[model samples]
Target: MRIRSNTGKIASVLIVVLSLLVTIPVAYAGDADALAATLSSGDRADADKVRDAGRKPAEVVTFLGVASGMTVIDLIAASGYYTEVLSVAVGEKGKVYAQNGAFVLKMREGANKNDNKELHRMTKAQAVKSVTDAGFEIVAEGEMLRNSEDDRAAYVFAEGMRGNTDRFVLKSRKP
Candidate 1:
């Protein structure tokens, strides 16, 4: 019974993953160092660098349809991981609104909150349902956006990003 249940869970997860793949578009096409290079950019913080392996920042941002000059809201900015990535992706003119969940907000009210002030360069606010209600449709949401490791575009520049040869695809959508 346990074996059967585990298999069922795996199958269900696979179904969700496959559905995400169908909806999300690739961010890297004929591009080479461009995609990986952006992820590995020195502009990113050292802390963010360590998280790259697990978070797959490049793939995640691209999947969200993030581009230079986008006004993005990092719904849950826990220590600004994705917020930092969005900052770089959006460029100076563009903006990132970093909002923490209720727990994080309550924690921030504590005493040890040192002056890690750069986080404020981004606006702080929760993005309520208003934007989506105003005609913005969410393009994609998932843990991983790349269709497959063997896919040509997903792993092409992974080495440049640190021995990660995951090609990336760039489905045309205006930046």
Candidate 2:
């Protein structure tokens, strides 16, 4: 579905698809509170703590349905801020891989600094088609992250692509 922003600049898409095959709930209320606690923990670096306001790691992870004991990967982990959060969220049972360089380079070969590149573009229709084409059924979809003022054509981070860009999430599983 196309969601238009209030300003109507341009609809930034945030798609989420989940397969009914999985019976597990996306997130538990307790888990969300734990994630919030993780964000406020003193173990996190002071610098990283400050970034929480903008990054909203807890909210992002919660929206992604990241729960305890779920393996997760933080590509382009940078300073391992997310890695730490995932590790704690996943507890000792699950694993969190924080990787960069070649691994990240491959997934983002043509991605520009501003994170705006045609090569990385995908319309909502195309995204759904791709998921179905992969033999998975999309059971759930969500517009968790949408920013209309986001200029997808912008070519540099200096232009404010950090939190200004739209992000989509999808959940699917094999039939």
lDDT winner? 2
* True-structure RMSD for candidate 2: 8.1
C-alpha displacement of 64 in model 2, angstroms? 3.5
Give the CA lDDT, 0 to 100, for residue 164 in model 1.
45
Query: Considering only N, C-alpha and C atoms within 3 Å, which residue pairs clash in candidate 2?
Result: 15-169, 16-141, 16-142, 16-169, 17-140, 17-170, 17-171, 18-140, 18-171
Question: Top model by TM-score, which number?
Answer: 2
Off by over 4 Å in 1: 1-33, 107-175
Q: Native-vs-model 1 lDDT?
A: 0.44
lDDT of each: 0.44, 0.54
Could you tell me the TM-score of candidate 1?
0.45
Backbone clash count for every predicted candidate, in the order shown: 14, 9
Question: Model 2: per-residue lDDT, tens digit, 8-98?
Answer: 1111222132122112233432365668776787578888887676566666566566666566666556567777876666666666776
Structural RMSD, model 1: 14.4
